[model samples]
Target: MTDPELTELRELAAQGDRDAVDQLVELAGERGDFDELRSLAAAGSSDAVDVLVELAGERGDVAELRRLADAGNQDAAELLAELTDED
Candidate 1:
Protein backbone atom coordinates (compact mmCIF):
# COMPACT_ATOMS: atom_id res chain seq x y z
CA MET A 1 0.00 0.00 0.00
CA THR A 2 1.05 3.56 -0.60
CA ASP A 3 2.13 5.54 2.47
CA PRO A 4 -1.00 7.67 2.46
CA GLU A 5 -3.32 4.68 2.15
CA LEU A 6 -1.49 2.82 4.87
CA THR A 7 -1.72 5.84 7.12
CA GLU A 8 -5.44 6.17 6.55
CA LEU A 9 -5.98 2.51 7.24
CA ARG A 10 -3.97 2.78 10.43
CA GLU A 11 -6.03 5.77 11.50
CA LEU A 12 -9.25 3.86 10.89
CA ALA A 13 -7.87 0.90 12.81
CA ALA A 14 -6.90 3.13 15.70
CA GLN A 15 -10.45 4.39 15.73
CA GLY A 16 -11.65 0.81 16.33
CA ASP A 17 -12.74 -0.09 12.83
CA ARG A 18 -12.82 -3.87 12.85
CA ASP A 19 -12.82 -4.13 9.06
CA ALA A 20 -9.79 -1.88 8.86
CA VAL A 21 -8.07 -3.97 11.47
CA ASP A 22 -8.83 -7.13 9.50
CA GLN A 23 -7.47 -5.55 6.35
CA LEU A 24 -4.28 -4.52 8.13
CA VAL A 25 -3.86 -8.01 9.52
CA GLU A 26 -4.28 -9.49 6.04
CA LEU A 27 -1.79 -7.08 4.57
CA ALA A 28 0.69 -7.69 7.36
CA GLY A 29 0.35 -11.44 6.98
CA GLU A 30 0.80 -11.27 3.22
CA ARG A 31 3.98 -9.23 3.66
CA GLY A 32 5.15 -11.32 6.57
CA ASP A 33 5.38 -8.14 8.58
CA PHE A 34 5.79 -9.49 12.06
CA ASP A 35 6.12 -6.10 13.72
CA GLU A 36 2.88 -4.90 12.17
CA LEU A 37 1.12 -8.08 13.20
CA ARG A 38 2.49 -7.78 16.71
CA SER A 39 1.30 -4.22 16.98
CA LEU A 40 -2.17 -5.17 15.80
CA ALA A 41 -2.27 -8.13 18.18
CA ALA A 42 -1.26 -5.83 21.01
CA ALA A 43 -4.18 -3.62 20.09
CA GLY A 44 -6.55 -6.61 20.68
CA SER A 45 -6.96 -8.09 17.23
CA SER A 46 -7.36 -11.82 17.59
CA ASP A 47 -7.10 -12.16 13.82
CA ALA A 48 -3.66 -10.64 14.01
CA VAL A 49 -2.68 -13.08 16.73
CA ASP A 50 -3.94 -16.00 14.66
CA VAL A 51 -1.95 -14.83 11.66
CA LEU A 52 1.16 -14.35 13.78
CA VAL A 53 0.83 -17.85 15.22
CA GLU A 54 0.39 -19.30 11.74
CA LEU A 55 3.37 -17.36 10.44
CA ALA A 56 5.56 -18.45 13.33
CA GLY A 57 4.52 -22.02 12.88
CA GLU A 58 5.20 -21.92 9.14
CA ARG A 59 8.64 -20.38 9.74
CA GLY A 60 9.39 -22.74 12.60
CA ASP A 61 10.14 -19.76 14.81
CA VAL A 62 10.03 -21.22 18.30
CA ALA A 63 11.11 -18.00 20.00
CA GLU A 64 8.32 -16.04 18.34
CA LEU A 65 5.85 -18.73 19.31
CA ARG A 66 7.12 -18.66 22.87
CA ARG A 67 6.78 -14.90 23.02
CA LEU A 68 3.21 -15.10 21.74
CA ALA A 69 2.45 -17.89 24.19
CA ASP A 70 3.90 -15.87 27.04
CA ALA A 71 1.70 -13.00 25.92
CA GLY A 72 -1.37 -15.21 26.57
CA ASN A 73 -2.23 -16.44 23.06
CA GLN A 74 -3.74 -19.87 23.58
CA ASP A 75 -3.26 -20.89 19.94
CA ALA A 76 0.38 -19.95 20.17
CA ALA A 77 0.81 -21.96 23.34
CA GLU A 78 -0.80 -25.00 21.76
CA LEU A 79 1.33 -24.69 18.64
CA LEU A 80 4.42 -24.21 20.78
CA ALA A 81 3.63 -27.44 22.61
CA GLU A 82 3.20 -29.25 19.31
CA LEU A 83 6.50 -27.89 18.05
CA THR A 84 8.24 -28.91 21.24
CA ASP A 85 6.90 -32.39 20.85
CA GLU A 86 8.40 -32.54 17.35
CA ASP A 87 11.89 -31.89 18.75
Candidate 2:
Protein backbone atom coordinates (compact mmCIF):
# COMPACT_ATOMS: atom_id res chain seq x y z
CA MET A 1 0.00 0.00 0.00
CA THR A 2 1.22 3.50 -0.83
CA ASP A 3 2.01 5.83 2.02
CA PRO A 4 -0.81 8.25 1.29
CA GLU A 5 -3.37 5.50 0.77
CA LEU A 6 -2.17 3.72 3.87
CA THR A 7 -2.35 6.97 5.81
CA GLU A 8 -5.82 7.64 4.49
CA LEU A 9 -7.03 4.18 5.49
CA ARG A 10 -5.51 4.54 8.93
CA GLU A 11 -7.23 7.89 9.36
CA LEU A 12 -10.50 6.46 8.09
CA ALA A 13 -10.21 3.54 10.47
CA ALA A 14 -9.52 5.89 13.37
CA GLN A 15 -12.60 7.84 12.33
CA GLY A 16 -14.77 4.69 12.38
CA ASP A 17 -14.80 3.99 8.66
CA ARG A 18 -15.60 0.28 8.78
CA ASP A 19 -15.41 0.03 5.02
CA ALA A 20 -12.00 1.62 4.93
CA VAL A 21 -10.71 -0.72 7.60
CA ASP A 22 -12.03 -3.62 5.56
CA GLN A 23 -10.44 -2.27 2.40
CA LEU A 24 -7.10 -1.93 4.11
CA VAL A 25 -7.24 -5.55 5.17
CA GLU A 26 -8.45 -6.78 1.81
CA LEU A 27 -5.89 -4.79 -0.15
CA ALA A 28 -3.23 -6.52 1.84
CA GLY A 29 -4.17 -9.91 0.45
CA GLU A 30 -5.60 -12.01 -2.34
CA ARG A 31 -9.34 -12.82 -2.07
CA GLY A 32 -9.36 -11.73 1.58
CA ASP A 33 -12.46 -10.22 3.22
CA PHE A 34 -12.55 -7.55 5.96
CA ASP A 35 -15.02 -8.89 8.52
CA GLU A 36 -13.44 -12.32 8.47
CA LEU A 37 -10.01 -10.77 8.81
CA ARG A 38 -10.81 -8.95 12.02
CA SER A 39 -12.32 -12.08 13.49
CA LEU A 40 -8.91 -13.73 13.22
CA ALA A 41 -8.42 -17.50 13.04
CA ALA A 42 -11.43 -18.28 15.19
CA ALA A 43 -13.60 -18.20 12.07
CA GLY A 44 -11.11 -20.07 9.87
CA SER A 45 -10.64 -16.89 7.91
CA SER A 46 -7.32 -17.18 6.10
CA ASP A 47 -7.86 -13.74 4.63
CA ALA A 48 -8.09 -12.49 8.15
CA VAL A 49 -4.97 -14.48 8.82
CA ASP A 50 -3.26 -12.83 5.90
CA VAL A 51 -4.37 -9.38 7.02
CA LEU A 52 -3.21 -9.90 10.58
CA VAL A 53 0.06 -11.31 9.29
CA GLU A 54 0.52 -8.24 7.13
CA LEU A 55 -0.29 -5.96 10.04
CA ALA A 56 2.19 -7.76 12.28
CA GLY A 57 4.84 -7.35 9.62
CA GLU A 58 4.24 -3.61 9.43
CA ARG A 59 3.56 -2.87 13.12
CA GLY A 60 5.59 -5.62 14.87
CA ASP A 61 2.96 -6.08 17.58
CA VAL A 62 4.32 -9.16 19.28
CA ALA A 63 1.19 -10.11 21.22
CA GLU A 64 -1.10 -10.10 18.21
CA LEU A 65 1.61 -11.71 16.16
CA ARG A 66 1.95 -14.47 18.72
CA ARG A 67 -1.78 -15.01 18.96
CA LEU A 68 -2.06 -15.31 15.22
CA ALA A 69 0.84 -17.73 15.22
CA ASP A 70 -0.67 -19.82 17.98
CA ALA A 71 -3.92 -19.87 16.09
CA GLY A 72 -2.07 -21.64 13.24
CA ASN A 73 -1.79 -18.82 10.76
CA GLN A 74 1.38 -19.92 9.00
CA ASP A 75 2.25 -16.59 7.46
CA ALA A 76 1.47 -14.78 10.67
CA ALA A 77 3.43 -17.38 12.61
CA GLU A 78 6.46 -16.92 10.42
CA LEU A 79 6.17 -13.16 10.58
CA LEU A 80 5.89 -13.31 14.36
CA ALA A 81 9.01 -15.42 14.55
CA GLU A 82 10.89 -12.95 12.40
CA LEU A 83 9.68 -9.91 14.27
CA THR A 84 10.16 -11.31 17.78
CA ASP A 85 13.43 -13.11 17.21
CA GLU A 86 16.22 -12.78 19.76
CA ASP A 87 18.79 -12.38 17.02
Candidate 3:
Protein backbone atom coordinates (compact mmCIF):
# COMPACT_ATOMS: atom_id res chain seq x y z
CA MET A 1 0.00 0.00 0.00
CA THR A 2 1.15 3.51 -0.69
CA ASP A 3 1.80 6.06 2.07
CA PRO A 4 -1.36 7.89 1.08
CA GLU A 5 -3.44 4.72 1.48
CA LEU A 6 -1.84 3.98 4.81
CA THR A 7 -2.58 7.49 5.99
CA GLU A 8 -6.19 7.07 4.96
CA LEU A 9 -6.41 3.71 6.75
CA ARG A 10 -4.95 5.17 9.92
CA GLU A 11 -7.39 8.03 9.82
CA LEU A 12 -10.29 5.60 9.35
CA ALA A 13 -9.22 3.46 12.27
CA ALA A 14 -8.74 6.52 14.47
CA GLN A 15 -12.30 7.47 13.74
CA GLY A 16 -13.62 4.00 14.77
CA ASP A 17 -14.80 3.19 11.29
CA ARG A 18 -15.71 -0.51 11.38
CA ASP A 19 -15.92 -0.90 7.60
CA ALA A 20 -12.46 0.55 7.27
CA VAL A 21 -11.20 -1.75 9.95
CA ASP A 22 -12.65 -4.83 8.26
CA GLN A 23 -11.47 -3.74 4.86
CA LEU A 24 -8.01 -3.07 6.15
CA VAL A 25 -7.81 -6.45 7.80
CA GLU A 26 -8.97 -8.18 4.67
CA LEU A 27 -6.55 -6.21 2.51
CA ALA A 28 -3.70 -6.90 4.88
CA GLY A 29 -4.44 -10.59 5.05
CA GLU A 30 -4.93 -10.99 1.33
CA ARG A 31 -2.22 -8.58 0.21
CA GLY A 32 0.48 -9.20 2.85
CA ASP A 33 -0.15 -5.96 4.65
CA PHE A 34 1.46 -7.44 7.74
CA ASP A 35 2.82 -4.17 9.03
CA GLU A 36 -0.64 -2.59 9.17
CA LEU A 37 -2.06 -5.68 10.84
CA ARG A 38 0.71 -5.59 13.37
CA SER A 39 0.09 -1.91 13.96
CA LEU A 40 -3.59 -2.53 14.67
CA ALA A 41 -2.81 -5.36 17.06
CA ALA A 42 -0.26 -3.22 18.87
CA ALA A 43 -2.80 -0.43 19.13
CA GLY A 44 -5.25 -2.69 21.03
CA SER A 45 -7.68 -3.04 18.19
CA SER A 46 -9.95 -5.97 18.96
CA ASP A 47 -10.28 -6.59 15.22
CA ALA A 48 -6.96 -8.43 15.36
CA VAL A 49 -8.53 -11.70 16.44
CA ASP A 50 -11.06 -13.86 14.67
CA VAL A 51 -12.67 -14.68 17.97
CA LEU A 52 -10.94 -12.63 20.65
CA VAL A 53 -7.55 -14.27 21.04
CA GLU A 54 -5.12 -12.08 22.94
CA LEU A 55 -2.45 -10.18 21.01
CA ALA A 56 1.07 -10.24 22.38
CA GLY A 57 0.92 -6.94 24.26
CA GLU A 58 -2.74 -6.64 25.18
CA ARG A 59 -3.43 -6.54 28.94
CA GLY A 60 -6.96 -7.83 28.92
CA ASP A 61 -9.23 -8.77 31.82
CA VAL A 62 -8.21 -11.86 33.76
CA ALA A 63 -10.96 -14.25 32.79
CA GLU A 64 -10.68 -13.38 29.15
CA LEU A 65 -6.92 -13.61 29.40
CA ARG A 66 -7.14 -17.04 30.94
CA ARG A 67 -9.52 -18.17 28.22
CA LEU A 68 -7.19 -16.95 25.54
CA ALA A 69 -4.23 -18.54 27.30
CA ASP A 70 -6.04 -21.82 27.41
CA ALA A 71 -6.67 -21.37 23.74
CA GLY A 72 -2.88 -20.96 23.27
CA ASN A 73 -1.92 -17.37 23.92
CA GLN A 74 1.33 -17.67 25.84
CA ASP A 75 1.70 -13.97 26.50
CA ALA A 76 -1.86 -13.81 27.75
CA ALA A 77 -1.20 -16.74 30.06
CA GLU A 78 1.92 -15.08 31.41
CA LEU A 79 0.05 -11.86 32.01
CA LEU A 80 -2.72 -13.76 33.74
CA ALA A 81 -0.20 -15.44 35.99
CA GLU A 82 1.40 -12.15 36.84
CA LEU A 83 -1.93 -10.46 37.42
CA THR A 84 -3.19 -13.29 39.61
CA ASP A 85 0.02 -13.35 41.61
CA GLU A 86 -0.47 -9.70 42.49
CA ASP A 87 -3.93 -10.35 43.91
Candidate 4:
Protein backbone atom coordinates (compact mmCIF):
# COMPACT_ATOMS: atom_id res chain seq x y z
CA MET A 1 0.00 0.00 0.00
CA THR A 2 1.19 3.51 -0.72
CA ASP A 3 1.95 5.63 2.29
CA PRO A 4 -0.59 8.37 2.89
CA GLU A 5 2.12 11.00 3.35
CA LEU A 6 3.76 10.02 0.09
CA THR A 7 0.44 10.22 -1.71
CA GLU A 8 -0.14 13.70 -0.38
CA LEU A 9 3.41 14.76 -1.18
CA ARG A 10 3.07 13.43 -4.71
CA GLU A 11 -0.07 15.46 -5.19
CA LEU A 12 1.68 18.61 -4.08
CA ALA A 13 4.72 17.83 -6.18
CA ALA A 14 2.57 17.40 -9.25
CA GLN A 15 1.29 20.90 -8.69
CA GLY A 16 4.85 22.25 -9.06
CA ASP A 17 5.51 23.06 -5.46
CA ARG A 18 9.29 23.00 -5.28
CA ASP A 19 9.53 22.05 -1.64
CA ALA A 20 6.96 19.33 -2.10
CA VAL A 21 8.79 18.14 -5.17
CA ASP A 22 11.97 17.85 -3.16
CA GLN A 23 10.14 15.95 -0.46
CA LEU A 24 8.60 13.64 -3.02
CA VAL A 25 12.05 12.97 -4.44
CA GLU A 26 13.27 11.97 -0.98
CA LEU A 27 10.25 9.78 -0.37
CA ALA A 28 10.51 8.22 -3.80
CA GLY A 29 14.13 7.40 -3.14
CA GLU A 30 13.21 5.82 0.18
CA ARG A 31 10.49 3.80 -1.52
CA GLY A 32 12.72 2.78 -4.44
CA ASP A 33 10.42 4.34 -7.05
CA PHE A 34 12.94 4.29 -9.88
CA ASP A 35 10.34 4.76 -12.62
CA GLU A 36 8.84 7.74 -10.90
CA LEU A 37 12.28 9.16 -10.30
CA ARG A 38 13.10 8.69 -13.96
CA SER A 39 9.91 10.51 -14.96
CA LEU A 40 10.69 13.39 -12.66
CA ALA A 41 14.22 13.58 -13.99
CA ALA A 42 12.95 13.63 -17.53
CA ALA A 43 10.70 16.49 -16.59
CA GLY A 44 13.89 18.50 -15.93
CA SER A 45 14.09 18.32 -12.22
CA SER A 46 17.81 18.40 -11.46
CA ASP A 47 17.31 17.11 -7.92
CA ALA A 48 15.32 14.21 -9.26
CA VAL A 49 18.03 13.58 -11.83
CA ASP A 50 20.58 13.28 -9.07
CA VAL A 51 18.50 10.76 -7.16
CA LEU A 52 17.52 8.92 -10.33
CA VAL A 53 21.13 8.54 -11.37
CA GLU A 54 22.07 7.21 -7.96
CA LEU A 55 19.20 4.77 -7.88
CA ALA A 56 19.74 3.65 -11.46
CA GLY A 57 23.38 3.03 -10.77
CA GLU A 58 22.59 1.08 -7.63
CA ARG A 59 19.98 -1.00 -9.42
CA GLY A 60 22.20 -1.54 -12.48
CA ASP A 61 19.55 -0.02 -14.74
CA VAL A 62 21.76 0.46 -17.77
CA ALA A 63 19.04 1.55 -20.19
CA GLU A 64 17.68 4.25 -17.96
CA LEU A 65 21.14 5.51 -17.12
CA ARG A 66 22.06 5.53 -20.78
CA ARG A 67 18.95 7.50 -21.62
CA LEU A 68 19.78 10.10 -19.02
CA ALA A 69 23.38 10.27 -20.14
CA ASP A 70 22.30 10.72 -23.74
CA ALA A 71 20.26 13.68 -22.58
CA GLY A 72 23.53 15.27 -21.39
CA ASN A 73 23.10 14.61 -17.71
CA GLN A 74 26.71 14.65 -16.51
CA ASP A 75 26.01 12.80 -13.30
CA ALA A 76 24.23 10.06 -15.17
CA ALA A 77 27.12 9.80 -17.60
CA GLU A 78 29.58 9.47 -14.75
CA LEU A 79 27.51 6.85 -12.98
CA LEU A 80 26.99 4.90 -16.18
CA ALA A 81 30.73 4.98 -16.77
CA GLU A 82 31.35 3.61 -13.29
CA LEU A 83 28.75 0.90 -13.75
CA THR A 84 30.12 -0.16 -17.14
CA ASP A 85 33.64 -0.17 -15.78
CA GLU A 86 32.61 -2.91 -13.40
CA ASP A 87 32.07 -5.24 -16.36
Candidate 5:
Protein backbone atom coordinates (compact mmCIF):
# COMPACT_ATOMS: atom_id res chain seq x y z
CA MET A 1 0.00 0.00 0.00
CA THR A 2 1.27 3.43 -0.91
CA ASP A 3 1.11 6.38 1.42
CA PRO A 4 -1.53 8.17 -0.60
CA GLU A 5 -3.66 5.02 -0.77
CA LEU A 6 -3.40 4.56 2.98
CA THR A 7 -4.29 8.17 3.55
CA GLU A 8 -7.25 7.89 1.24
CA LEU A 9 -8.49 4.76 2.99
CA ARG A 10 -8.12 6.43 6.36
CA GLU A 11 -10.12 9.37 5.14
CA LEU A 12 -12.86 7.14 3.79
CA ALA A 13 -12.94 5.08 6.95
CA ALA A 14 -13.12 8.21 9.06
CA GLN A 15 -16.21 9.19 7.09
CA GLY A 16 -18.10 6.02 8.15
CA ASP A 17 -17.51 4.08 4.97
CA ARG A 18 -17.94 0.39 5.74
CA ASP A 19 -16.32 -0.72 2.48
CA ALA A 20 -13.28 1.38 3.24
CA VAL A 21 -13.08 -0.04 6.71
CA ASP A 22 -13.25 -3.58 5.42
CA GLN A 23 -10.62 -2.85 2.79
CA LEU A 24 -8.32 -1.33 5.35
CA VAL A 25 -8.83 -4.24 7.68
CA GLU A 26 -8.01 -6.69 4.91
CA LEU A 27 -4.89 -4.82 3.93
CA ALA A 28 -3.75 -4.45 7.51
CA GLY A 29 -4.24 -8.15 8.18
CA GLU A 30 -2.33 -9.10 5.05
CA ARG A 31 0.54 -6.86 6.04
CA GLY A 32 0.41 -7.93 9.67
CA ASP A 33 -0.01 -4.29 10.59
CA PHE A 34 -1.20 -4.62 14.16
CA ASP A 35 -1.41 -0.91 14.84
CA GLU A 36 -3.67 -0.33 11.87
CA LEU A 37 -5.84 -3.27 12.88
CA ARG A 38 -5.96 -2.04 16.47
CA SER A 39 -7.02 1.39 15.33
CA LEU A 40 -9.78 -0.12 13.23
CA ALA A 41 -10.88 -2.36 16.08
CA ALA A 42 -11.00 0.60 18.42
CA ALA A 43 -13.23 2.31 15.92
CA GLY A 44 -15.80 -0.52 16.38
CA SER A 45 -14.93 -2.84 13.55
CA SER A 46 -15.67 -6.39 14.66
CA ASP A 47 -13.91 -7.72 11.55
CA ALA A 48 -10.77 -5.92 12.60
CA VAL A 49 -11.06 -7.34 16.10
CA ASP A 50 -11.47 -10.82 14.68
CA VAL A 51 -8.39 -10.41 12.48
CA LEU A 52 -6.37 -8.99 15.35
CA VAL A 53 -7.28 -11.92 17.54
CA GLU A 54 -6.33 -14.42 14.85
CA LEU A 55 -3.02 -12.73 14.14
CA ALA A 56 -2.11 -12.48 17.82
CA GLY A 57 -2.96 -16.12 18.37
CA GLU A 58 -1.02 -17.25 15.32
CA ARG A 59 2.02 -15.39 16.56
CA GLY A 60 1.57 -16.60 20.15
CA ASP A 61 1.65 -13.01 21.35
CA VAL A 62 0.48 -13.37 24.92
CA ALA A 63 0.90 -9.70 25.80
CA GLU A 64 -1.10 -8.56 22.80
CA LEU A 65 -3.79 -11.12 23.49
CA ARG A 66 -3.91 -10.12 27.14
CA ARG A 67 -4.30 -6.48 26.21
CA LEU A 68 -7.12 -7.27 23.83
CA ALA A 69 -8.79 -9.48 26.41
CA ASP A 70 -8.56 -6.72 28.99
CA ALA A 71 -10.20 -4.51 26.44
CA GLY A 72 -13.22 -6.90 26.57
CA ASN A 73 -12.46 -8.82 23.40
CA GLN A 74 -13.99 -12.25 23.92
CA ASP A 75 -12.24 -13.86 20.97
CA ALA A 76 -8.90 -12.68 22.30
CA ALA A 77 -9.80 -13.96 25.74
CA GLU A 78 -10.71 -17.38 24.36
CA LEU A 79 -7.54 -17.55 22.28
CA LEU A 80 -5.48 -16.50 25.25
CA ALA A 81 -7.05 -19.26 27.32
CA GLU A 82 -6.40 -21.82 24.64
CA LEU A 83 -2.79 -20.78 24.26
CA THR A 84 -2.16 -20.83 28.03
CA ASP A 85 -3.82 -24.19 28.32
CA GLU A 86 -1.11 -25.61 26.11
CA ASP A 87 1.48 -24.77 28.73
Candidate 6:
Protein backbone atom coordinates (compact mmCIF):
# COMPACT_ATOMS: atom_id res chain seq x y z
CA MET A 1 0.00 0.00 0.00
CA THR A 2 1.03 3.54 -0.62
CA ASP A 3 1.97 5.92 2.12
CA PRO A 4 -1.12 7.99 1.44
CA GLU A 5 -3.41 4.96 1.76
CA LEU A 6 -1.69 3.90 4.93
CA THR A 7 -1.99 7.36 6.41
CA GLU A 8 -5.69 7.48 5.59
CA LEU A 9 -6.27 4.02 6.99
CA ARG A 10 -4.50 4.93 10.20
CA GLU A 11 -6.61 8.01 10.64
CA LEU A 12 -9.82 6.13 10.06
CA ALA A 13 -8.75 3.19 12.14
CA ALA A 14 -7.96 5.46 15.07
CA GLN A 15 -11.59 6.40 15.00
CA GLY A 16 -12.64 2.72 15.21
CA ASP A 17 -13.88 2.51 11.65
CA ARG A 18 -14.56 -1.14 10.91
CA ASP A 19 -13.63 -1.01 7.20
CA ALA A 20 -10.42 0.84 7.97
CA VAL A 21 -9.57 -1.62 10.72
CA ASP A 22 -10.19 -4.56 8.39
CA GLN A 23 -8.05 -3.01 5.67
CA LEU A 24 -5.26 -2.38 8.15
CA VAL A 25 -5.46 -5.98 9.32
CA GLU A 26 -5.22 -7.26 5.74
CA LEU A 27 -2.31 -4.98 4.98
CA ALA A 28 -0.45 -6.01 8.09
CA GLY A 29 -1.13 -9.68 7.39
CA GLU A 30 0.20 -9.35 3.84
CA ARG A 31 3.30 -7.70 5.24
CA GLY A 32 3.66 -10.41 7.89
CA ASP A 33 3.49 -7.86 10.70
CA PHE A 34 1.50 -9.42 13.46
CA ASP A 35 3.06 -6.91 15.82
CA GLU A 36 1.10 -4.14 14.14
CA LEU A 37 -2.07 -6.18 14.52
CA ARG A 38 -1.22 -6.79 18.15
CA SER A 39 -0.71 -3.07 18.67
CA LEU A 40 -4.05 -2.30 17.11
CA ALA A 41 -5.71 -4.97 19.21
CA ALA A 42 -4.15 -3.48 22.30
CA ALA A 43 -5.77 -0.22 21.33
CA GLY A 44 -9.18 -1.94 21.53
CA SER A 45 -9.93 -2.74 17.92
CA SER A 46 -12.11 -5.81 17.87
CA ASP A 47 -11.37 -6.35 14.18
CA ALA A 48 -7.67 -6.40 14.91
CA VAL A 49 -8.19 -8.77 17.78
CA ASP A 50 -10.11 -11.15 15.53
CA VAL A 51 -7.42 -11.13 12.86
CA LEU A 52 -4.68 -11.57 15.44
CA VAL A 53 -6.42 -14.53 16.99
CA GLU A 54 -6.92 -16.19 13.62
CA LEU A 55 -3.34 -15.66 12.52
CA ALA A 56 -1.86 -16.72 15.86
CA GLY A 57 -4.02 -19.83 15.92
CA GLU A 58 -3.04 -20.74 12.35
CA ARG A 59 0.64 -20.37 13.22
CA GLY A 60 0.15 -22.31 16.46
CA ASP A 61 1.44 -19.33 18.38
CA VAL A 62 0.34 -20.48 21.78
CA ALA A 63 2.10 -17.67 23.61
CA GLU A 64 0.50 -14.95 21.56
CA LEU A 65 -2.93 -16.54 21.82
CA ARG A 66 -2.54 -16.94 25.56
CA ARG A 67 -1.51 -13.33 25.94
CA LEU A 68 -4.55 -12.12 24.05
CA ALA A 69 -6.80 -14.44 25.98
CA ASP A 70 -5.39 -13.18 29.24
CA ALA A 71 -6.07 -9.70 28.01
CA GLY A 72 -9.75 -10.69 27.77
CA ASN A 73 -10.14 -11.34 24.08
CA GLN A 74 -13.10 -13.65 23.69
CA ASP A 75 -12.09 -14.88 20.25
CA ALA A 76 -8.62 -15.58 21.50
CA ALA A 77 -10.01 -17.45 24.47
CA GLU A 78 -12.19 -19.58 22.22
CA LEU A 79 -9.45 -20.30 19.71
CA LEU A 80 -7.00 -21.03 22.50
CA ALA A 81 -9.45 -23.54 23.90
CA GLU A 82 -9.70 -25.28 20.54
CA LEU A 83 -5.95 -25.28 20.07
CA THR A 84 -5.27 -26.63 23.54
CA ASP A 85 -7.98 -29.26 23.13
CA GLU A 86 -6.28 -30.48 19.97
CA ASP A 87 -3.15 -31.19 21.97
- Model 3 score (lDDT): 0.64
Cα lDDT of model 4 by residue, 1-87, tens digit: 357877887788788888988877787788888877877776667888888888888899999899989989898899889889989
Model 2 worst lDDT window (10 residues): 39-48
- Model 1, total clashes: 0
What C-alpha root-mean-square deviation, in Å, does candidate 5 show against the real structure? 1.0
Question: Each candidate: what lDDT?
Answer: 0.95, 0.65, 0.64, 0.82, 0.96, 0.85
The TM-score leader among the candidates is 5
| TM-score per candidate, chains pooled | 0.92, 0.51, 0.46, 0.79, 0.93, 0.74
Candidates sorted by TM-score, best first: 5, 1, 4, 6, 2, 3
User: In candidate 3, how many Å is residue 80 off?
Assistant: 20
Error of 2 at 64 (Å): 0.7
- Ten contiguous residues with the weakest lDDT in model 4: 1-10
TM-score of 1: 0.92
Task: Name model 3 segments beyond 4 Å from true.
Answer: 1-6, 50-87
lDDT: worst 10-residue window of model 5: 70-79
User: Cα deviation in Å at residue 51, candidate 1?
Assistant: 0.4
Q: After superposition, how far is residue 70 of candidate 4 from its true place, in Å?
A: 0.9
Clashes of each: 0, 1, 0, 0, 0, 0
lDDT score for residue 5 of model 1: 98
lDDT of 5 by residue, 1-87 (tens): 799998999999999999999999999999999999999998999999999999999999999999999999898999999999999
Summarize candidate 6's per-residue lDDT along 1-87 as a digit string, tens digits. 789989999999889788888888888877768888887877777767778888898899989999989988888888889989999
The segments of candidate 5 whose C-alpha lies over 4 angstroms from its true place after superposition are: none
